[model samples]
Target: IDGGLLSPEAVAADPCPHGMTRELCGLLCGDDDPAVTVDPDRPVGFALALDCQLAGDSPELLDDAQLLDVVEGAERMERWASALRTRMLAVFADRHPPGSSAPPPGADSGAAAPVGRWLPDQVALTLRVSLEEARCMLAGAVRFAHVLPATLAEWEAGRIDERKADAIAHATSVLTDEVAREVEARVLPGAAAAPRRLLQDRLRRTVARVDPQGAARRHERAKADRRMSISRSDDGMASLWLSAAAEQTEASWRSVDRLARSLG
Candidate 1:
């Protein structure tokens, strides 16, 4: 009935028999008695924690080999969960399927009906997420699962993380299939090593290079579609939101900053 013992995190943070705190939160808990008893701050204890899927006690415990494996393993777990979510999204997408030959209730018999009509609503309800999040994730899942094999492979191997994969996905979305492969070939190698912001800039640049016409069209569209809105915050505040070309937005932001500083 101990509340702290309720999760693996609690277990690893428990004290070791040696009186030094166990490095892992869950590796030393639950009365199972570790087969190898050592301070989690030590290599054996850290390895044991990682092997058992608990949080590591400390980074110092990992050797170069263990460090590599543990970091890669963390990414592998993220990749696995993303793949699982994609499959689950597929289950929802296929509940009625998008391209059924049959007509819907209000349609003529020969017309092709849109199926899976309730997918976003059902997903939101089941996952307890907002409808916007559900729809975006569903779209991302479909894109990642079906179209981006190279990025997916890199992510699965832990060579790249979800954010980088997402960056690749967003950058390539406007590209034709042939052009996207070219972009992937150029971008995927550096994704894991590059900081995400730097990778995003590179990816955008590459996408422009690989598909100049498409990039130009999207840029023009973005410029033309600049939008602003007012939204109320939960804490009795209001936010003025605006989205436009980067240069224009930055200029506007600088003006606001200048005005605010002048009064101060």
Candidate 2:
């Protein structure tokens, strides 16, 4: 679980108490419960069961013991990918220093600043994603490297998922360095086992407690940017977007609900 490689003999010596094979037990560090046997033939089933367990749901399949290996393997792969992403972003940052807005020599004259404005185009082309998606990816990588070092370390170590890392980064993005560290330190210890929404809620409370005045100030500034927009698709379906103060949005929702109920 800690990523230390074990020899085949070492793994064979430490079989799971719950009837799991040496390979599966060694890979997943044994099942959480001694009574629940992990099926060696179907590690993926155990992984699905664990997911359903985490989601407060139940799986009807095979008593939930087959999916462990697949889940653990996928998590390890994602951790490696995340680490690679950070390294790539580091290379990008090094080439396009935030302070130096000039384009690389012999590059297009259209490559103007907000430094690194043109780099995401290269990433987009390489990764087969839209320009905006690549830009967001770079932004997130930068945030992890610069503002959320502990979160980055955990992500690299495979202790937390990238989504959880994103939650921490987004929640603390508005805080000052000192306050952000404090909030991060308080919530990060148990982050590996915490659900994304629960982790986000914890981050919110920690931020409020750590810097009430700063939170209030940011809220005020954010309110100034509040607006509404709508997007329409070719299928005649439309989606509305509201960026507003929380209380204001809630009040509007309540009014709409009341009118809808009266009409009904």
Candidate 3:
């Protein structure tokens, strides 16, 4: 059977009679099988299961909406993990410098310890990559975070790895000032306050098209509601605290009335 067009069941069954490895299995599984465990004891079995999942005859088995959700969730997890690794590397690199075999100021105790005495065997185990790979990833992350100069100094100290650096970089890139502004525009309350801003905009446009004067009146009303504050009691019930100003109160009432009419 062609590798590209094998059924799920067929893929599950051992495709290669000779012998297969866990890494190969993972490649086949495509990364979202909870049942596909990967550990020292059952590495081979895990690998095989993954291979089957990946090699399953129809791609549809993994391309459905549900699968897409899984992929998205996994991507998010990986991205976060990568970010964490980067942060860890940065911290370590700051502690240890490159080429010099001297420990930090406080690292020296009583007599004398080993040359690399402060090196922890497992600084951050969550980083599944080797120290070298982690350092590289960290480098990428530092670059992304716009803190490359400081991060580079840390990296030279032998505290972080590449993977972590890369993750930090990626997270920083996604959280740029521009992206923050976009998010604020969409979700923040000041200007485009409502959850349905687009809907409101469309409604306003429609109302204006139907009745220009009414639309203007309605717009004023909306502005009034924004000015009106809402306070919540200890029990969580909200109370509208209308302005004491007569003109403002009248505007608020008009806004409420307009909204009611629009809803009806």
Candidate 3 worst ten-residue window by lDDT: 35-44
User: Residue 115 lDDT in model 1?
Assistant: 57
Better of 1 and 2 by lDDT: 2
RMSD of 3: 20.7
For model 3, residues 79-125, the per-residue Cα lDDT tens digits are 44444555665566554544435543455555434424433323324
Candidate 2 error regions (>4 Å): 1-64, 95-122, 130-136, 233-237
In the range 132-153, model 1's lDDT, one tens digit per residue, is 9988888877776667877876
Top candidate on lDDT is 2
How well is each residue in 1-264 modelled by candidate 2, as lDDT tens digits? 335455566667874334334334433564454333332233233343443243222223324343454356456546656766776776686678666676644578776566666677777887899999988888877767776788888877667877888888889988887777888899999998899889999999989999999889988999999999999988789988999999999998999899999998
Residue 78's C-alpha lDDT in candidate 3?
Answer: 44
Where is model 1 more than 4 Å wrong at Cα? 1-72, 84-97, 100-139, 234-236
TM-score computed on alpha carbons, candidate 2: 0.63
lDDT of each: 0.68, 0.70, 0.45
CA lDDT of 5 in candidate 2?
A: 56
Clashes of 1: 7
